[model samples]
Target: MSTELTRNFSIIAHIDHGKTTLSDRLLEFTSTISDRQKQDQLLDAMDLEREKGITIKSHPVAMKYKAKDGKTYNLNLLDTPGHVDFSYEVARSLAACEGAILMIDAAQGVEAQTMANLHLALDQNLLIIPVLNKIDLPAADVDKCKQQLEDILAIPAEDAIPASAKNGIGIEDILEAVVARVPAPVENPDKLLRATVFDSIYDAFRGVVSYVRVFSGSIRKGQRIKLFATGKTYEVKECGVFTPKMTKRDELVAGDVGYFIANMKTADEAKIGDTVTDSTHPCPEALPGYKEIQPMVFSGIYPVDSSDYEALKMAMGKLQINDAAFTFSSESSTALGFGFRCGFLGLLHMEIIQERLRREFNMDVISTYPSVIYQVTKTNGEEEIVDNPTMLPEQQVIQEIREPMVRIFIMIPGDYIGDIMALVMEKRGEVTHTETIDDMRIMLTAELPLAEILIDFNDRMKSMTRGYGSMDYEHCGYRPAKMVKMDIMIASEPVEAFSTIVHRDKAEGYGRALAIRLKDVIPQQLFVVAIQACIGGKIIASERISAMRKNVTAKCYGGDISRKRKLLEKQKKGKEKMKAFGKVNIPQDAFIKVLKSGD
Candidate 1:
């Protein structure tokens, strides 16, 4: 097909706003899939995504839609994830398209992520097609949704299309609007090949298969391609487009979105956002690549059994190929043994990885508490980035500690604004701005320490607002605070696995709570064990596990009282010796009991 008859666009939205559902409807409407082949969320390939009702990866498909003007257009549709953690996926998809369908729930109105995605689409200068999905429900107020669109996003209310992806309403109107509004690609095909790699996957038998959006020239089988990022060259063995599946295409011209298999032995070479050009006549400049992912959350992942360490290593390697944001390195702890310190974009990303490890690779694993990177400035004018609490230096060496801060936007029902504001203050967050969306809803912008909201802050907000709250955030910067590293010690020895960095003001109460939870799980030995939560040399909180008594005087009831006293005294001396020299064995179950995340 010619470039003039081709349209490239993506469906972007907030979580569960029906991006995937809309994709399914479009694919079916265009006959991209047969009646028997059609199913819900057909674009969501992962089992975890289907089970969770979330889109973890962006899916690309090609369709042939005959418009009302009686012209068949080749449409490249990209369906992007909506959750904040997967915003990176949306950005990647947007880079390859000329337009986006901004999806919003009709009953819910504009949400935090909806605004976040809208800003991303505007940044790319793409044409936006506002869509109010799920309009069939009784609660969906078309007038209110359209008004919110004009008020918050500044998009004209008349342009917003009201449709239900579930019942297939306005499917033809959406397709017709897409063909009329979205512009065709204009890159020259005669120029040297410069294909931008939006995504790629590791195929066991086929090696690395790259998904590319051709910018100039064309790519085909038997062509030699040069990867701009790694400066590696390979001969393309096959090329194909996704009719939702890999169907062979003789050649992919400029403006085409397709996958090509090269002899890329390792996943490291075919990086996403890489520019591919002809090896014999390479493009002078590589296309601008996506910014590198800076992990917002960090945690330690260990195999349940020590012998599965190598297997876990292989599993992580496989996962890293598909997800560029996830990162890990070799680490060890006294309680958990050998493990990898993994970095994730957010809590959801972390959970998805753990789920994938269990379901896909069958790698049973345990993870320690999640943490964020901290900036530590020393007294001698040196600075260090610490993710793990055990890497924190001694109290005497640190000058000031800075923690990551995020600017969070929370939208909730207006009636609970006071209660939600109180919860924010409880988490050491300050409300910066508040705007009423309408008579019923309000949006609150706040600055919060990343660590403070890492665990249960979202849960609390939802409960307080009666499940009418939604939140999205972006990292603003770091701010200096009175931060300290607290350690859990058993019998005077600190366990590296249970160490955490916390605010100084909350250390007392937080430490006491942790110590109490630990006391319940750690088994009692022959000698009394002291569990202490310590900040440097001073203990903030402490708990003790009583020793199990043997009752040595049970067999000497008729003996003299001195005999019983001597036995008791001997036992006490033995217990004292044990307490002084005994090495405490923290059970695996104890680590699981204490370290499992609240999510």
Candidate 2:
């Protein structure tokens, strides 16, 4: 197809805003899938995504649509993840498109994430088409949501399309709007070949399959290509486009979206956001807006069976091919054995990776509590990054410590404003501004520590507002804070995996709560198990699990009382000896349960 006949676009929305459902409708309207093969959330592809009703990865598909204007156009659709954790993925997807379809829930109206993504689309200078989905529901207020788009985003109500993606209502109108409004890609087939790699996956039979958007020229089968970022060249074994599935093609031309298979062994060589250009006639400059993704949360992942360490590493290698945002390195703990300290975009990203390792690889793994990275400076004028609390330097040598901060945006009903303010204040947040979106709703902005809200802040906000509140946040550099390292010790030995960085004001309370909770979960051993929380050398909280008692006197009920007393003393002495020499065997589940307590 020629460049003028092609339109590249992406569908973006907040979580549960019907982005996938709308994409499914478009596929059906274009007759891309047979009626027998049609299913709800057809673009999701993964079992976890289907069950969770969320898109974990960005997907691209090409369709041929016959518009009402008697023209057949090639439409390329990119479905992006809606969660805040995957914002980086969304940004990369937008960079590959010339337009975006901004979807909003008709009943929910504009949300925190909606505004965040809208700003990203605007920054990219992409033509945005505002859409209100799920209009068939009786509760859906199309008029009110249209007003929201105007007041919050400055989008005209008439320009917004209201449709029921679930029932295929107004699907034709949306497709027609794409043809009439969205502009076509600029043709440059005569220039040097330059394609942008937006996504990729590993194939056991074919090696790495990279999804690309051709900008300046063409890529044919058997041609040599070089990656602009890595400066590595590879022979293109096969080239094709996604017909919702891989279909081999002779060549992929300019303004086309497709995949190319090269005999590349690993994902690091063909990194996302890299430029692919012809080896013989290379492009002098790479594309702009390429930035490395930084992880916001860090945790330790250990295999339940120590022998599975190698298998775990191999599994991670495969998973990383699809997810470039995740990072890990070798780390060891005396309590947990060999493991990897992994970094993630956010809490949801951390959970999804853990779940995939267990379900897809069939490996049982233990994950420690998530933490934010901190900057620590030494007395000798040296600075280091500390993701794990056990890696923190000694208190005497530390000159200063800084923790990450975020600018948080929240939207909730006016009735619950007081409760939300109280919750944010408790987390050491300061309110910066407030504005009324409508008579019944308001938006609140605050500056909060990243550590305080990385775990349970979203759950708490929903609970306080009766499931009517939504929130989104972005990293806002770092600031100095009064922090301390708190450690948990079992049987007088510190467990490095359980150590964490906490604020000094709440250290005592958090320590007491954690100690009490660990005592209940850890099984009672032959010897009494003492769980203590300490800072530096001072024990702030302690709890004890009494040893299991064996009825030593049951067999001598008819014996003399002195004889029974003698047996009791011997038992007491034996227990004391066990307590002094025996080591406690902590179970795997106990560690998981203890770490999940604070959330």
Candidate 3:
């Protein structure tokens, strides 16, 4: 085993609790970034994360922090995803770190998600360094937060350094604590070289760049290393350490973290939790890795033009390089023709990826309602997966279907507890446990079917809690819950392209909301639209829009029949492109709107 000389720790915090900001200060302290032009959340370089004010992905950075005792040590830091949807990613990243810096908001103390992460860290047996962040704020109550942390986390409260990461207060103290309390990384050099890949990103020129922490022995460039999970060997072309903005140093040793570039190009081959070992002297056994993440939330995405299908595929492919949770396959429909079926970690993840695809890839897409995958077993004992609600097998063919269940945790003030409980009960959620956080706050744990959360759960939770609640969930298991297939009908006829399987309790609300949203975004055409929600053969509710009763006059204004005829022809061509649903001709924009609203 390696001596504890350099510690590997990750910064785990709730959304917007200054995890990235503190990370930036750490980088500045290490001279990775210029002191004159320091930016907030340097690691959150993605435009979407910045706009959302959340960390959607985990980023790893290496820095050299000099302790107050005059000892220089290497620090490999991982900035983990703060959202509940990316909980699986956080777990994988946690496995790579020996310790974690738990950052708690001073005013908020410990949130539902903070407990969830702390529990995960405990499960992984990682040493934890607790810090109370934003303590300089007027609302900051460092003493109370430290007490709460000590009681809940069972970690020492006296060492809970209070920091205002924004102003750089207590940063040196935080570093000193990390160096003093957090043990260093493993330093077993004589053992077989073993490393755990925690994250990866694709570089167009470099192929798949894998981020790994050497746990056992040494590795150098050009060494043949076998990926234990897949038994594939690759000669390392390059190895180095990383900062938020740069990659420095080479030939990383055990207890140190670094990146390696392989000539291998595929992303799947470099899975997040896969183990890498010396091919010649392979470890007798491979490190235990996680199961392949199956996406529970799915949606259809189509290009505005048929010619852009290839571009859309490439864009999704590029995104999947870093995000292993993103699942996609080319699909076709009679109504929308050819498109892509995208699978996500959850609804939020699905929405973020879709938004990123549109905004970053510059691809206008027509998306379908997000649905969960159901189990289907054929008569001949064939197992099948049904992700698209429209493509589900006939009722008779599906012997049994199940909905995914999630273990949910919520923290809210006492005043709003009634509202939150009522909301949960309405969504078919069952309370499993509850704990009092303080006089007015409680932590509620429940097991909820994932289908119930696909809708406006976040918005509804915030509204019910008066913006004083936080919720996070992890997939528990699939349960045979009371579920139904809700068909989206257009003009009394079920549109196979617009179907979803929702919990019976939520079908009507979602159906009505979908109709309303579609009504708003569908453009006016020569014919009216009939948006109806159906369950099996019964139409629960329906809405109608009258046809385009008025359009530009056919009269030639200034002998520009070319423009007028072109306009009319364009209208006719657009009308012709729509799939006929009785008297309704739904526009592409309506499809996009309905899908976005589903999130």
On lDDT, the candidate that comes out on top is 1
Alpha-carbon RMSD, each predicted model: 1.2, 2.0, 6.2
RMSD of 1: 1.2
Off by over 4 Å in 1: 597-599
Off by over 4 Å in 3: 1-4, 376-385, 396-400, 491-493, 505-532, 543-586, 597-599
Arranged by lDDT with the best first, the candidates are: 1, 2, 3
Best model number under TM-score:
1
Q: Model 2's lDDT to the true fold?
A: 0.90
Candidate 2's residue-wise lDDT over 1-599, tens digit each? Answer: 77888999999999999999999999999998889878898888878899998999999999999988788999999999999899988998999889999999998889999999998898889999988999999889999998888899999999999899999988998888887788898855468898999989888888889999999889999999999888989899999888788888999998889999989878678698999999989988887745798999999999989999999998888888889898888999887899999999999999999999998899899888788999999899999999999889998899999999999999999999999999999999998999999887899999999999988899999999998899999999999999889999899988887899999889889889988988889888877888999989999999999989998989896957998899989999999999889888788788778766653
TM-score of each: 0.98, 0.96, 0.87
- Full-model lDDT for every candidate: 0.91, 0.90, 0.79
**TM-score between candidate 3 and the true structure:** 0.87
Among all windows of ten consecutive residues in candidate 1, which has the lowest summed lDDT? 590-599
The deviation in Å at residue 35 for candidate 2 is: 1.2
Note the residue pairs that clash in candidate 2: none
